[model samples]
Target: MNFKELHNQKTPLLLGNVWDVPSAKTAEKLGFQAIGTSSSAIAALLGYQDGEQMGFSELIYFVKQIVTNTNLPLSVDLESGYSRDPIIIAEHIKELVALGVVGINIEDSIVKDERILLNGEKFASTLIDVINVLSKENIDVFINVRTDTFLLKHSDVIEETKKRIKLYENAGANGIFTPCIENESDIREIVNCTSLPINVMCMPNLPDFNTLSSLGVQRISMGNFLFDTMYSQLERITKDIIDQRSFQSIF
Candidate 1:
């Protein structure tokens, strides 16, 4: 199935990301129409760090596994497309498409300064080339261009967010992802920028389902939150065991 077509919905497709085959099946059984793979969660599962830990070959294997286990259209988190070279990144995009991924989340948040950094003009330049290359491949790969400005820099967050969206749209991004925005006004500004779908991180204490739906957010991702929650829960239980305290089911 062409995954981008799924996003052309009256209500945005709410994708639940899975790290492994079982998780993908579980999500599929839970009535989620589409399933995504989390790069963080998958990397943690394989005992590696995120971003280029596993090369395209290994990533292709994982995507194939996810596809084999379930029939849902898969959207993969190809962390920074696994390379800096736009040609290599484009090749990786084609590899993912060959592996049956219907969508991909490519981000400009290159790891630097111990946080996400946005090289606005450079990333935009690369994105245009990447999209152009993929178009030649003749696959309608859904590109959810991720912008990490809000998560990294807070100064004039609204203006920076708009700038990134404009650049991404010009680069042919199917949608725009602003990972963590604090307030509703900022979300509104992004919503007003372009008609393309806007994506947000699903923070527990932040916007509720109704609020997100009202804000015109077409996509909401859990990112590493689910993986972090798993780690925290396991650590808490292990600590309780060491302390001889009753580990009641907190799940």
Candidate 2:
């Protein structure tokens, strides 16, 4: 399905990011309309670190597996296209489309200091190049370009964020993502600046549900929250069982 069309629907698409085939199948079975692959989840599953630690072949393999397992639309987090070279990244996008992903989330962030680092102009330029390549294919693959301004600890959040949104939109991104914009006004400002759907992360400081829905957010993603939660809960439960103690407290 086209990402923009999906966004135009009355209810925003809620995507659950999965790490493997079983999880994807289970999510589809549970009636989720679409499923996304979390980069961090995939990295943890492969016993490698995130942020390009896994290569293109590995990513395509995983995407192919997920596609084989489920009928739902799959959106992959192809972190920075796993290469800085724009041409290579564009070619990789074509390959990912071949693997049957309906959408992709490419970020403007490089990994450093235990967090995402923004490379706004470079990332946007590569994305524009990738879009041109996809155009030649005559295919409509959703390119949800992610910006890390809100996610990072940086100044000039507004100007920097505006620069990214405008650049990527001009670059032909199907949608935009700002991972952790906690303040309502900040979120509102972003929504106002771009006509493309704004996808936000569901975190602890998430805006009130009613308020967010009123703000014109077209999509919401759980990102790596599900995997982290599962890991944390499993650890707690097993530790309690091993210690002959009952698991207590609701998550």
Tens-digit per-residue lDDT, 132-196, candidate 2: 87788786788898898888856999778988899999989889999988788888899999999
Q: Native-vs-model 2 lDDT?
A: 0.84
Give all TM-scores, in the order shown: 0.90, 0.92
**Candidate 2: residue 168 Cα off by (Å):** 0.7
| Residue 8 of model 2, lDDT score | 77
Question: Worst lDDT window (10 residues) for model 2?
Answer: 242-251
Name every residue pair that clashes in candidate 1: none
Looking at model 1, residue 66 earns an lDDT score of 90
Instruction: Tell me the lDDT of model 1 at 148.
Output: 78
Q: How accurate is candidate 1 locally (lDDT)?
A: 0.81
**Among these predicted structures, which one has the highest lDDT?**
2
Each prediction's total of clashing residue pairs, residues at least 3 apart in sequence or on different chains, is 0, 0
